[model samples]
Target: MVPSSHFNHIRDNTDLKLELKIPELNSQFARNSHNIPPYAQNKPPKPPNLALKISMAAKTTEAPSLSFPRDIFAALSPSPFLLAHLSPQTPSTPSIRPNGRAPSEFRKPTIHRGSLTHCSGSAVVRLGDTAVVCGVRGEILLAADIPNPPSAPPQPAATDASDADADDEDDSAELSQLSLLVPNIELATGSTPTHLPGSPPSTLAQSLTARLRALLLSTRLIRARDLRILHRAPPPPDAAATPDVPPTEEAKAYWTLYIDTLFISLDGNAFDAAWAAVVVALRDTRLPRAWWDDDVEAILCSDVPAEARALRLRGLPVAASFAVFAPGGGVGDSAFRDGQEERAWVLSDPDAFEEALCPEVVTVTVDCTGGERRVRRIEKSGGSTVGRELMKGVVQRAEERWKDWLEVFGVGNS
Candidate 1:
C-alpha cells in the first residue's frame, strides 16, 4: 500500500485536501479497490492562465484570405475593364461614357440668326439636342405714359422731422419703374415630357427668367442708356412751326424691350442654350426711328428700312455648365488600407443621361467683351462644395468656349 507521506504537502495547502479515511471493499470489488484512490476533496481549482485563454479566444474569428499587404491586394484585384464597368458613366471614358467627347469638351452648337422675319429680332440656338428660340420687341414710352413713373414727393408735414424721411422713403418706393429689359421664359410640351400644354409656367421656367434678368442687369450686358429714345418736345400752343425755327431740346423717352425665350427641346444645358439664344437675338434687334410732330403734338415712328438702327449691346456673356460626379462615403477594407476620400470628376456640357447621374452642378458665366475675359457669375446647386481650383479651371474653359462661339457668330471682340 502507498504511504500517506506522498500527499503530506497537500495538507498544508488551502487549495487541496486529502481524504484520511478509506472504505473497506467487499469481495466482489476488492481487486479493483486499489485502482481507486481518495484524492483532494472539495478543493477549489486553480485559476486558468489568462494569456493562454486569450490566445485560444482569438482563433475563433475568421481571417482574411489574402495575406499580402492591403495596398498590393487591392491593386491586384479588380481589372481595369471591371473597374470601368463598376464606376459611374462619364463623358471621357469610351467604355461607359455615352458621348465620345473628352471630359472638358463642349458640344458644338448650331445657331440660326434672324430666323423669324416678322419679329424685330430673333434667333434659334441648338446645343446637342437642346434648342431655344429667342425674340426681342422694342416700343417707345413717354415719360408720363411709362408704368410707375418717377414723380416729386409732396412737402413733409411740419410736425416731425423723422416723418419727413419716412414720407420720402415711401415716395421713392412708389416712383420705382418697371425694368425696361423684361425677360420671359416658357417651356412648352415639346421641350420635355413633364411640361404640359396650357399648364402654368413651370417653376423651372420662372427661375430661368428671373436668373437671366438678374444676370443681364448685374453684369451690364446691355446698357440701359442705349435703349433710350429721344424726341423733341412739342411746341407750345402759341409757338409757330417754321422751318427756320431752332430745334427744341429733346425730351428723353425710354425703350421697353420685351425679350421672350422659348425652349423647343431640352436634353441638358438649358440655361446655357437659353442665354446664348438671348445674346444672339439681341444682337439681331433693330429699333425704328422716332420724331416729334409740332403740329400734332405727338411722337411719330416710321417703319422704313432706312430709318431703323441696330440696338447697341455692351458685352458678351458666355456660360459653361458642369456636372460633377463623386463616389459616396466608404472606408477601405482590410485589403485596402490606403483608402481614397471622395473622388470627383468634372464633366463639361454633359448630355441628359450624364446629367441625370450627377446631383451636383456648376454653371460659370464669363464676359469676353473688349478682348478681355471676366467671370460674371458662378452658380452652384447641390450638397457639394466646388473647390477654388475647379472654379478657375471652369472659367478658363469658358473663355475658350467664348472664343469659339464668337467665331461662329462672326463677331469681333474689339
Candidate 2:
C-alpha cells in the first residue's frame, strides 16, 4: 500500500551500495587467498602410498606367524585334528597318531603282582594312562548253607575214562550253576570325568562286572577241584581187617572267590585293563588249604604258607581292544561313492583323546598258550567298519598281545 515513488527510491539506493561493495569484496578474497597459511590451505589428499602399503603387507606375511598350540587345537577340534594326523598329506610321510603311536600299535602293559597284601591275590595293571587294581578274596561257603545244593556226581570208577570225563563235566557245570565266582567293579571318583564323587555304581561298572563273570565261566580259567574241600570219613578202628569197605569221601564246602576291580585312573580301554588285572590277580592268588571241621562244624583254612596251593589256570588269555576311526563320516554314509574307498584306521589301545573321536570299537580275547591260537571272545559295537577279514586280523593281533602278556606273566612263549 506504500507509494511507488518510495519503493523505487529504496531499490535504486540498494543497487548503488551493492555496486560499490562488489569490487572491495573481490579484492579482499584475492588478498586472503595469497596470504593464507600453508596448513590452512585446502589441498587434495595425496594418493594413498600403494608401494608403502604393499611393503607393510609383505612384511606382515613374512613375519613369524602366530598359531594355536597343538593341545589347544586338538581340544578345539578333536575330530579334524585326529583326521589330519591319521590321513597325512604326503604319501611318503609315515602316518602317526597325535600320541606318537602308529595305528594298530598297542600300548605295552605293565603289571605288578601281589600289590595288595590283605587280599588272597591282587595285581595292578597299567595300559597307557589307564590303571586298575584287582583283588581276589576267597570266602568259604559250607555245602549245608547253600539253599539248593547241586547233587553230588557219582564216584568215577578207576580206569573208566567215560566216567572220569563225565565227572570233570559235572565239576565245571557245578561251578557255573553255584555262582561261585562273583565280580564287582568300582570306578573311583576322579578316575574319569564321567564317574562323579558320591554317586552309585554306574551302568558301565555293572556291565563290566557281568562281562567279567561271563568270561571267567566261559574260559574255565580256574579248576573246580582246587576250590572243593573234601572230607573223608576214617575207617572204623577195627575195620583194617575189612579191606572190602572203602573210605567214603564227600565235598563239605566250596571256596567262593570275590573278584573286585577298582579303576584308579581311566584313560580308555577300561575293559581290557580290568580283564588283564583280573587274570593276573587270579594267577598270583594262593588259597590256603581249607578243610571241614566235623567237631566245630566250621570250615578252617590252614595258616601255614606251605600248605597253601596256587590256583591252576587253564591257559593264558589276553584281551586286546581296537577302535575304528572313519574320518569322512559315520557308518552307512556315501564314503565309498565315486571310486573313493572309505578310509578307516584300526587303532589299538586307543587313549582317551582318540577314543573320543572313534565311533566303532572291537575287543578280542585270545589264548595262544597252545600251539594254535584260540579266540575266546569277540565283542564289537558302534559301526560296520570292521568286517570278517578285519576281524581275522584283529584276532591275529590279539594273539600277539597274548604272547606279550605271557611274557609279562613270566611265562615263556609257548
Candidate 3:
C-alpha cells in the first residue's frame, strides 16, 4: 500500500495526455452537432426505406396471377367443388352439376345391335362415358348328359285344363333348375383403374352376373318351349294293329345360352349399362332351328339363315341409377341447405367424380313397354337418405329413362 515505485509505474501506464484531450473532444462534438443531419443526431442510422423499396419492386414485377383449372380444382376438393357448382353465389346463376347437366337429367343412351359377327348375338350400349358390349352364344345341352334330369310331364289330354296348369308349372322352373342360362361379366383392365390387367373376376363382375342370371330366371324372359328339342318316338311294329295310339314326343335336348358381357369403358352406373347391353343383345339373338336326329343319335341344326328363329322377349326393362350427395357442416356453413339440416342432391347417372363423393345409391329397373310402369328390381344401398318420397321421384325418373331407352331401340310409346 506504500509502494512509491508501483504508484509511479501505474501513473506512467495511464495516459494523462488522454485526460487532457477529453475536453477538446467534447468541444469537437458540440461543433459537429450543428452540422449533423437531423435524422443522424442522437439516434442510430435509420434503416433503408424498406417500404418504398418494396413498393418500387412490386411495381416492376406486377403481372396477372394465374388460377387453377376447373379439373384440377375438382380433383383437389371434389365435394366442395361440386357444391360450389350446385349452389351458386348469385340468384342469376343457375344451379347445375360440374358436367353442366341438371340434377335429374340423364345422359342420352346410344345402342348398336349386332356389333360382333362371330357371336350368335351382340350389342354395344353406351350411356355417357360408360360402354358395355354383350354377346350371346347358344350351345346344345343334351338331357342325357344331365346328372339329375327333371321328371317328364304326362301327356296332356286335348282339352284338359288341369294338365295345362301342370305343364305351365313345370315350364316355369325348367331354366332355373336345369341351370341352362349362364351369365358372365368381365371388367376390362383399361376400362377402369380399379380393374387391373390379369386380375381375377372382381366382386362387381360376379355380382352383376348373379343379378343378370336372377333377372333372367325371375322374369321368365326366355320360354322353355323355345329351348326344348323334341324327338318323336317311332310307332312300335304292332302299332298298325292299334290305330288309336299316337307316337310320343320326348324332350331329347335343350339349348343353353351363355350371355357374356365386357366393359369397354366404365365411368359410372356399370350395372345399368351392363343390363341394357344384355337386353339388347338377347333381343338381337337368332338361334338356328335345331332338332334331335334319331339316326345319328345327336342334335342337328339347320344351316339356312331363314331357318333361324329370334327370341321372344317378354318386356323391355330399363335401369336408372342415382346417387345422393349430402355435404357435411354446421348451419349456414354450407351453400346447400333445407329447413334445418343440410340438403341432399339426387344425381341421376352420376359420373365417376360424382360417384366418388356420393355415399347413397339407388338403382331402379322399370318396364314401361306395356303402357303401364312395372318395377322389376329396386336396389338401394349406402345410406338411408332415400325415403318414400325420394323413391317415388326415383321411379318417375326411371320411367323417363325407360322411355329414352325405347326411343334408342326405335320403339315408340304405344
Candidate 4:
C-alpha cells in the first residue's frame, strides 16, 4: 500500500479544489512519488519573498538597451532601402516640402530671455522643433594675466586718440576679452531618435563651434571695449619723480566673458538656433561691479546687484540655412534635358528628415546692425552646384528673418 505521506500536499484551497477533479491522476502521481527515493521529497519550498527578490535582482542587473521610435527605425533600419523598388506608378504631389510649405518659407521662431538666474545672461530659443539655451558669465582678470594674448605688434606711435583706441582694440581682440571662448553642443536624449544619448559631439557639432567662433570675431558682433573692466589704483610713490609730466590715472584690473551653449532639441537648423541663442544671451548679459584693493592688490567684486552693468552688443548677425532637393537625377545632371520642368527645391530651415534626404545645403549669415543689413558670411556645401543668384536670394531671406527676430526681441519694429 502506498503511503499518503508521499502525496504532494496542495496547501492552497484553489489547488486542492482543482486536484479533486482529477482524482485518478492525483492518486497515480502519489503512488509514483512513493516509489521514488526519500532524497527527492527532502526539497524545500521556494520562499515567495526570495523568489520575488531573485526576479527583482535579475531586472536590476540587466543593462538597459537603446530604444528608437518606429519612424526613426524606418529611417535608420534596412526596411526602407529594401522596399525602395516598390515605388508607386502614378506621379506624386508637386509640392516638395515635407510639411507643404513654400520653398523659401521658414518656421516661426520663439525666444525667451533670462531663463537662468545664476548666469550673467541666459536665453532659450526654439525654431520649429529645434531648441537651444545659451548662458554668458563674466570674470575679472589682470591685463598681464590674460590667456592666449595675441602677440602685440610694436606699439604704433600714439599719435592721436584714434591710435590709442586702435591699440586697445588690437590687444583686446573680441576673444581676448575672455581667456577662452568655450562652446560645446550636446545632443540631448529623447530630443530625437537619430542622436544617440551619451555620445560625443559629432563632426557637425565641431564644425558649428568653429563657425560660431569665427563669426563672433570676424563680424565683431560683441564689442571688445564693452568687455573691458577698469580698476583704479594709486600711482606708485616716487618722491615726485618726473615732475615735468602730469600725473595720469592707472588701471589695476581687467575682465572677460565665458559663453556656454547647450542644444536641447535638434531637428536641423541647429546652427540657426544656437546662433540666435548666443545673440539673445549676449544682449541680456551684465557685468558685476568690481574694484581693485590697493592693500591686497586683488580685485573685489560687489555682491550688490544694483552695481552690475549691461554689456552692449555691437551688432546682430542672423543665420539662415536652406536644403537643396533635386528630383530626376542629381543637380546639374543630363536629367534636365528636353526642357523638363525644374523639379529642384530649396527648402528653408529644413527639419531632420528633410535635411537627411536633401543632398545640398546652403547657409547664409547676415549682419542686421543699426537698421542696416549686409551679408556677413555664406556657407555652401554638397554636390549640387548653386548659382550666385540663388545665394543672393538666400541672403535676402536671411535679412528678412533678422528683421523679424529684431522686432520680436523689441530691438526694432515688426
TM-scores for candidates 1 onward, in order: 0.65, 0.80, 0.78, 0.67
Worst 10 residues of 4 by lDDT: 78-87
Query: By descending lDDT, how would the candidates be arranged?
Result: 2, 3, 1, 4
lDDT of 4 at 78: 26
Q: Each candidate: RMSD to true structure?
A: 16.8, 6.1, 7.2, 16.7
Error of 4 at 240 (Å): 8.5
Candidate 1 vs 2: which has more TM-score: 2
Worst 10 residues of 1 by lDDT: 167-176
Q: Report the number of backbone clashes for model 3.
A: 0
Q: Where is model 2 more than 4 Å wrong at Cα? A: 1-66, 154-172, 234-246, 330-341
lDDT of 3 at 183: 94
- For all candidates, the clash counts are 0, 0, 0, 0
Using TM-score, give the best candidate's number: 2
Candidate 1 residue-wise lDDT, 178-271, digit = tens: 4678899998677887788999989989999988887777666664444545454556765675645544444446677889998989988889
Write the number of the candidate with greater TM-score, choosing between 2 and 4.
Answer: 2
Q: Rate the local accuracy (lDDT) of all candidates.
A: 0.71, 0.84, 0.84, 0.69
Off by over 4 Å in 1: 1-96, 147-176, 233-252, 329-341
